[model samples]
Target: MRTQVAIIGGGPSGLLLSQLLYTKGIDSVVLERRSRDYVLSRIRAGVLETGFVDLMKQAGVADRMEREGFVHDGTQIAFDGEMFRIDFKKLIGKTVMVYGQTEVTRDLYDARDAAGGTVLHECSAVNPRDLDTDAPYVTFLKDGQVHRLDCDFVAGCDGFHGPSRQAIPTDIRREYERTYPFGWLGILSETPPVDDELIYANSERGFALCSMRNDNLSRYYIQCDLSDTPDDWTDDAFWDELKRRIPDEAADKLVTGPSIEKSIAPLRSFVCEPMRWGRLFLAGDAAHIVPPTGAKGLNTAASDIHYLFEGFDRHYNDGDSDALDRYSEKALARIWKTQRFSWWMTTQLHRFPDQTEFDLKVQQAELAFLRDNEAAQKALAESYTGMPY
Candidate 1:
């Protein structure tokens, strides 16, 4: 089989890229190693940056999101028993939407199916071959048979552990990574949120975040040991810890319930440089990863897709290869900025294992400045709502 672009992943990044290219009259095939149901069942961040929302609209999959997603104008930050709100709309005339990644994937899948796009699920041993040459192909096993897909270019959207990044020769690939000493113990409950907007709290005990999918489904998280497991805490215990980390007033009104889903995810900041290797290009987690504190995981991936799509569109429609040539430079410039923001937010909100009294005081002062100074709040709001794409 032959296509203009062979996408090696069925996640949001791959699906979004495929749908976008299809709208432009480009043909591509998406290969996934897992079932469609399995992909949609994984719970992820619901906060959507403005750029990502616009990309969804451009891909013609924003009907459901516009109808169901909630618009958040601002967010709350709590520390030392005091809470303050940073208004994104007031600061920058912009806002973010609360829409789950699962819903976004579902919408893209529906659009792809309606357009008769090719998406193969449960294909194993997918590998990219001849990435350094003009004629590249991808091979995989399906139904006990090996198949090859030839394409002009290959898109690696299979994520951090996927094969696409590894395809780049070690001699050419450069990686930067920083793993946090803690993890986030998160839970989903069928209850109303403690506040209308998301609350990021830093307390004496630890850090906690109050977020939600909708009015009836609340998602909460608290800092935990890197070695901690979901089995270490019960529903009631998780609730208690979350309450302690937020302001007393918000905790007083917090609703408690049984958790429907629970997990512990370690935090890390990672980036692989030079996203493009000859005819092969990497997008999303295949090329970079950011700590979830600033909610940049999927949004950064969307930014990569934006740059990649622009490169492809220019190359095919106008016979311009400049965008493709600068794809890595442009994408990496933005990825590093996002990494700094995520790292800063994580450091400010969480308690480091080696945190001293002076460090605690400095963190408190920083939060105080953010609350009292307009400049600081605006800076935070700008990064939170996302920088220009």
Candidate 2:
């Protein structure tokens, strides 16, 4: 098989990139290690930065999103049993969309299918070969048979554990990672949200976030020990812990229901410098991962896709390789800033195992500064809504 680009993942990043490229008459093939059902089954972050929403629009998959996704003009921050709102629209003149990552993947998959794009699910042992050369190709196993796909370039949107990043020689690939001591124990429930907008709370026990997929489906999370597992907490126990971390007002109105999905996700900030390796370009989790505190996991991935698509457009249509040449630098520049924001948010809200009384006071002081100072709020709002592309 031959294609202009061989995408080594069928997640939102890979699917979005392929769909976006298709609009420009670029052809690509997406390979997924799991079945389509498995891919869509994973629940992820729901917040969408303005930049990601625009990318969805550009990819021609915004019909459902614009119709169903809620527009969040601001978010709430709670500390010391009190809550304050940060008006993103008022401070930064922009807003974020509350759309599930699952929905985003579904829309991209639908668009890809409608366009008759090639998306090979259950493709295993995927490997990108000769990435440093002009003739790059990908090989994978399917149905007990091995298939090779020749392409002009390879897109490593296969995520953190995928083969794309591993294909880069260790001598050339530089990886940086910081794993948090805690994890987020999240649950999805069919109940109205506790608040109109998302609430990020820092309490004496831990950090909690109240987010929603729609008006009816709520997603909530509370900080937990890394040793904890989903099976350790019952539905009632999870709700009780969450209520303890949020403000009394929200807790009073909080609706409890049977949890539809539950999981514990470890927080980490990881980045692989130089997202591009010759004809192979890494996008999304293959290049970097942020702690979910600032909701940059998918948003940063969209930014990478944005840059990679621009590079491809310039190379194929305008015959300019400048963007392609600087893909790693440009993508990394934006990614590091995002990592910083996510790290700062996580540090501010989460209670570390080693946190002292002084440390707690510092976190309180920082939150207080953000609550009282307009400049600080504006800065938080800018990062929360997203930095410019």
Candidate 3:
């Protein structure tokens, strides 16, 4: 179908873009390869920056979230069995809300349905052509039938592995990547959290995080070998590893139950530029992906969409292409800053088994100094909660 924008991938980026454009009197359709249930029920990260909450509220989708989501003023960093809290209010005058990505997607899905918006699931996109050229269409396979969709512009929010990037001419794209030696073994448990605030712990074993989704559910992650898979660890093994990494004074407090979900996420920092080519634009994972250590993935995607909508507004309403032309450079500035922060946090917290004793001691000393130094603590707080964007 013809529309103002043809959005690929109905994840947070694509869906949110459609909603934002819809409110601006623009028409768009979202194409998703997964069912609504899969997107809604999937256990994803659960931290929302203050700006993110403001955007959602302005979009008129924060009613249920305001009631159901948990708000936290700060997070704790623990090492050597000692905990240091960074007060977000004192640091940035903002607090983050603990709300899972699943809930946000579900709310957006319901909003789209109620607004009579289209979200095509289980439809695989083959090749999306350029709008500047003669062929401006998206080819997809649906119901065992190949269909061609013509649209005014395309928004490639399909993620890092999706076909949207493959549609780009290789020579025009410059890709930058850095893969970490370790990955995260993430798990969701039915047990309540061991602590009220999220904890980032550094120990001899590795890095461990204790976070909660709600009163009844908890989420945890531990550093694992990059090549490790979900099947590599049993439930007991997982708990043992977690205990070794997570420092706890209360022996029986960090309790866990049957894991509802388990997955291995490889750590990587990547960026593909420029984010625009001809009439096609890219946002979210389609454009860049930062390591999850800083919890900037979803928030970055939302910021990308915000800037994109501004560009679209300038182009369509004011007949100004300046914002569209500068979108990539503008977005990438915030992107690389976050990428460095995430990488810094990752390196500081996670221990590499191959490192010498001297290296380990250096890292430990750095952490210890940062814990006591107000300047360093303020720096971490600024990066963790975001500076302005």
Candidate 4:
């Protein structure tokens, strides 16, 4: 079937893009390789930046968020037994919400269905081409048959491994990547959260971030070897490490219940230049990825959708191609900033097991500087809150 736009990937980016286009009286078809259930259940980096909250409110998906999402004014940075709060409001002129990406996905999925947008699941995109013809076409495989879909435009929200980005010739795109030596072993506990504001602690053992999905559900992460799996750390080992990482005063109050779930994720930063090529535009993880330390993944995806639709409006409705032409450079400006922040945060907090004594001391000193300097604190808060589009 023909459409105004064909969105690849059913993640937040593709779903949100379709919803936004529908608001503007445009029709788009979203193709997702995974089932709706899988997408709904997938856990992600939970913190939502300030700009993302604004977008959700604008899209009318914030009702549940308003009712359920936890709001925090700041996060605490603890090092050497001293805790200093980085008041997000005081630092960035805004505060963030502790909301999971799963909730956002569910909210947007329901909104898309309510708006009568099509989301094709369990359907793989074999190849997507930006036919230079007057009408661009995207061909995909669904139900064991190749379907050729003609469209006014295509959105490559499919992610880093998806086929959309490969449509651009390797010569035209420059790829940048950095892989961290450590990963986060996250856990969801049955007990209440240890504190209200999130705690990012730098300790002799390693790094630990104390956060929550809700008052009853706590989400915590500890630095681990990149090769470490959930099986490597027993429940007792996990609690012991957690207790050591948390400050002495906070340790007694921090309760460790049976871990409801556990998972390990390696840290990395990735970006591909020029987010758009001809009729195909890349958004979200399809275009770039940031380490989870900065908590910018979901927010970056939201910004990408906004910019993609803005470009779509200029190109399709206003008879102007300027926005469409500059979409890549425009989005990457924020993408790289977050990449730097995530990388910096990762390095400042996590103790690389492989690093020398001098390097470890340097990491400690950097954390100390962040705590003592107002300008540096403001920089962290600003990026954590998000940079404007």
RMSD of each: 0.6, 0.7, 1.7, 1.5
Candidate 1 stretches greater than 4 Å from native: none
Q: Write the per-residue lDDT of candidate 4 for residues 1-389, one digit (tens) a residue.
A: 89989998999888878877877777899999989999988878778887788878767778999899988888988888768889889766788888888898899999998988889888876577754456788788889998888888889889888988888888888889888888899998878898898899888888998988888888889999987999999888998898899898767789888898899998888999888777888899988888888788878988888888888877778889898888888899878888888888888888876889899888888888888899988988888888888
Predicted candidate 2 versus true structure: per-residue lDDT over 158-253, tens digit per residue: 999999889889999999999999999999999999999999999999999999999889999999999999999999999999999999999999
> Model 1 residue 316 lDDT?
94
lDDT of 2: 0.94
For candidate 4, the clash count comes to: 1
Q: What is each predicted model's overall lDDT from 0 to 1?
A: 0.95, 0.94, 0.83, 0.85
Model 3 spans with C-alpha error above 4 angstroms = none
Off by over 4 Å in 2: none
**Any runs in candidate 4 off by more than 4 Å, and if so which?**
131-133
Which candidate number has the best lDDT?
1
lDDT: worst 10-residue window of model 1: 380-389
TM per candidate comes to: 0.99, 0.99, 0.95, 0.96
Root-mean-square deviation of Cα positions for candidate 3 versus the true structure, in angstroms? 1.7
Question: What is the per-residue lDDT of model 3 for residues 1-389, given as tens digits with 9 covering 90 to 100?
Answer: 67778898999888888887877777888888888778777777789877778778866788889999998888888788777887877866778889999888888888788889988998875567865664477888889998777887888899998888767789998999998889899999998898888988888788899899999899999999987899999988998888877666622588878899999999899999888887788899998898888788998888888888888877777889899888888888888888889888888888876889898888889888888887887787777776565
Lowest lDDT block of 10, candidate 3: 243-252
* lDDT head-to-head 1 vs 2, winner: 1
